[model samples]
Target: CATGSAAVRQGIRAIDANAARIVLVVGAEQMTTTSGPEIGKNLLKASYLPEEGDTPAGFAGVFGQIAQAYFQRYGDQSDALAMIAAKNHRNGVDNPYAQMRKDFGYEFCRHESEKNPFVAGPLKRTDCSLVSDGAAALVLADTATALKMRRAVAFRANEHVQDFLPMSKRDILAFEGCEQAWNQALNKAGVTLDDLSFVETHDCFTIAELIEYEAMGLAKPGEGAKLALDGETAKDGRLPVNPSGGLKAKGHPIGATGVSMHVLSAMQLVGEAGGIQVPGAKLGGIFNMGGAAVANYVSILDRIR
Candidate 1:
């Protein structure tokens, strides 16, 4: 489930320990081949089955509940969520690998129509990530070996944090695990959020991206909506985010998402990202989570060669 980032972590550890000079990390998922009902059932297995097994919309239902709680405390964020979807969709248009590259405007995403009906809680279909099948791979090597390569993106920091699985055991909307992972990674990298040129975060759903804005210290809690509304996360804004469309449009091939995020960030760092490249990107941040923030991973990357 969390194997995407976990694989990267283990690969780095192996190299760090001098056990391996280079490690190949691969993540692939073939989710679209299955029937819809079976897909839902399989995804449900990622949840705390004892309590969330019967959730109506599978993982979407769980995130929907989180969205509902957030709205209750922060007022309705439908507009902000819609803006995020629209923004990501627009970004996806430039992503050659995106699953859905068509831009659906904010109005279409904000208002629920037959095409974007409510799937769970107040989350419309537009607010959810697509079921995608994709594969992404990375080759990690020691610093000396990496420097000799034509282009290299060095990991300044990488951190992983795990939290309780059951929603009852923790505050579902807080995303404490995500916050912790980001904090630890930044601290280890000896940098602050402002040092990042861009970020590629997990947007399993639009709400997840909204909350992640806060979890990553971009904004205060309950006020993450302002970042999107103010255009701070736009590709040309203060700090560009998800220039790759994130999971919202780039696709959430569950097993491959985390590695995909890292690959995209690395692309930006090395100036290899074509259409989705953030201008003058020197440092990049990446956050990838699994199971409603249960498994949190953060990485900071900078081009060394």
Candidate 2:
């Protein structure tokens, strides 16, 4: 189901094992043709059907429950979630390939009207990523071969950690698997969170991004909201995040999201990102997960050429 990042991970493994000189990883999904109810039913299968099969709104409803839990533990973060939504939407305007290119201001995102009604739990329509149809591919080669290319982005480290599928087993809000994956990747790369120039994280829902700030060590648990409210994740902030507009604005085509993130990060490193470029970016981080952080993957990339 989350084969995008898994494909890249396996491709790199194959190269490391001398099984291949170059590998092409492609992720594609065509979902718009299906009926809304059918899409929801299909996506719901990714979750543990025994426990979450009846979740309202499918994946959105699952994340909505996570949002409610987060609000209860850390106090209401509705305003912060709205800020994230607005920020990503604003960033999307510059992305030529993004699904929604309009900048929805903070006020509009914060207050829901008929145009943006509540979807699941506390999440409004704007808070959830759009259902999209897309495809993205990237080529991975060994260091020696990549050096011969005109431009190359090397993978400093790539780590994947899977957690219990049933949300009933773990503290759903902690995203422990995500934290572990990030820590492992950064350690293997010999870098800290501060060393990253930018990040392209999975923002399937605004609440997910808010919690991810904490999981990725940008803030202490229950304090992630402050990062958004204080502009710490803005394009010009201390550590810019989601310069690609994230799934929140870029559109989440399920299978395509992970490879798309790597493609965009590679673009940023090579100065090909156009308006969404992070100035003087050297190292970029990517986080892509599936089924409420069950399949957590983190990659730290550096420009080698």
Candidate 3:
């Protein structure tokens, strides 16, 4: 932590001093079976070089721990994440662009069958995100250049925020960085939560989507869980969320997630989305996080073109 922090601090200072216009930060993680294990080995190598056996478990194998702490602290009901999965699956069933198009119910996920296995304590094979190899890009243009491009999708607002590295260091119930990013995006979009007809967030796990309601200010602090239970986040709900099937069902392509979020949201606005289209979506939100909420990016997009 000390070493990495020092480098980041130095980088930020240099950029600020040089009058850099913008910074497009992305986390492109494409760890295959061999790569996943290798990353685990690398984390262990970096931290416990002298004592290899004492290193932390595989980094890819840690979402469950975060989910466990999340549900424990946030107070979830009936693994509400299942509803999020359902939403994504149903959406994917129609998304020709989606990685997973088959629809699976919560019943099967709750009761582990031949396929689904428990990854972390409470997170199941079906509950976790998929290791998809994909890419997403963001064209961060200055206000004038972005407006002049005319051929490009303008990133009206690209806000970045951060949280504690370790889950124990911050509140697991809600994403503080998400809230900050949300505020910045909405402000840049010149709208409020109500103005957005739909949203796309990093549903790496169902729990992340639940907290997004609060972070995005779509739901009250702890009441965001009800959005899932009440069908409010459904495709035709009052405020639909993750209409693109999300990382859980659509597949989590780390490098491409942020850009994908914008692309999916843009589809909704333009009415090009095959089956996951929202009725009259004009404004949308795309929220992406890296490394268990370590870094956050919130983008607000509209159909001005």
Candidate 4:
């Protein structure tokens, strides 16, 4: 992320920067074997693990618990959160590279399945995303540089936004800054949601997807779940999301995730995506979330030609 950001800063440096026209970003992770569970357990600890030896089974669970409390205190939506899990799992099936290619139906998810075990409260194993090894790369070029190329996609927009990582003293679910990032990104690109062909947001869990709907303004706060339940975020939706199956199905490799999101977005935008391609996508959006909803980066890309 810093690399891409630095490249942008350098590109705009002073006025006379290098003639570089392209920037490539890639994300890779390898978490095979039974170790996947243990590794995932550790990642969930980043949010709010009990430092005093409480050793909760999940960090996000702590957040989930907190979000639950927040909702109890400030209204919450359970249906919306479930949509997050269902959307990504369904999306993953089309992604041959995804770790968990098996898509569990909502009924199966609710009742539990052979592989879908319960993890944390309100967070079943199926509701969570995967930890797998994979890589995604992006080919970016400036508008002027891209126009000269026989094959290239336009760098329509790229904006970075930061959010409160430490959920300790803040409104956990009301991540307005995340919503702001989308506004800034779309504003810079001079387009609206109607202009976007598709979106690839972080779906670390069902709850994440639900919250993203609210954050991205796809739905009113807590209305994100409806998108999933109604299949509005599905492949055939007006605005298809996570055609690559997303992290839930595509696999999340931590540091590589952000880069991978951009890479996939570029692929879909350029019609390089095979089975996952939307009918007519001229523009795309990618939302990569990290470190307990603390860091969110959004990028917008369009076909250069």
RMSD of 1: 0.8
The pairs that clash in candidate 2 are none
Badly placed stretches (over 4 Å) of model 4 are 1-19, 33-55, 70-82
Task: List lDDT for all candidates, in order.
Answer: 0.92, 0.93, 0.67, 0.67
lDDT of each residue in 42-107, candidate 4, tens digit only: 575455444412435455465456446645654654554555566667777776667777667666
Q: Output the TM-score of candidate 2.
A: 0.99
Residue-level error in angstroms, candidate 4, position 18:
3.4
- Which residue pairs collide in model 3, if any? 135-256, 136-256
- For model 2, residues 4-41, the per-residue Cα lDDT tens digits are 99999999999999999999999999999999999899
TM, every model? 0.98, 0.99, 0.78, 0.84
Top model number, lDDT? 2
Supply candidate 1's per-residue lDDT for 165: 91
Candidate 1: what lDDT?
0.92
**Candidate 2: stretches off by over 4 Å:** none
List, residue by residue over 1-305, the lDDT tens digit for candidate 1.
46799999999999989999999999999998899989889888878999999999898898899999999999999999999999999999999999999999899999989999999999999999999999999999999999999999999999999999998999888899999999999999999999999999988889999999999999999999999999899898898889998899989998899889889889888888999999889999999998989999999999999
TM for candidate 3 is 0.78
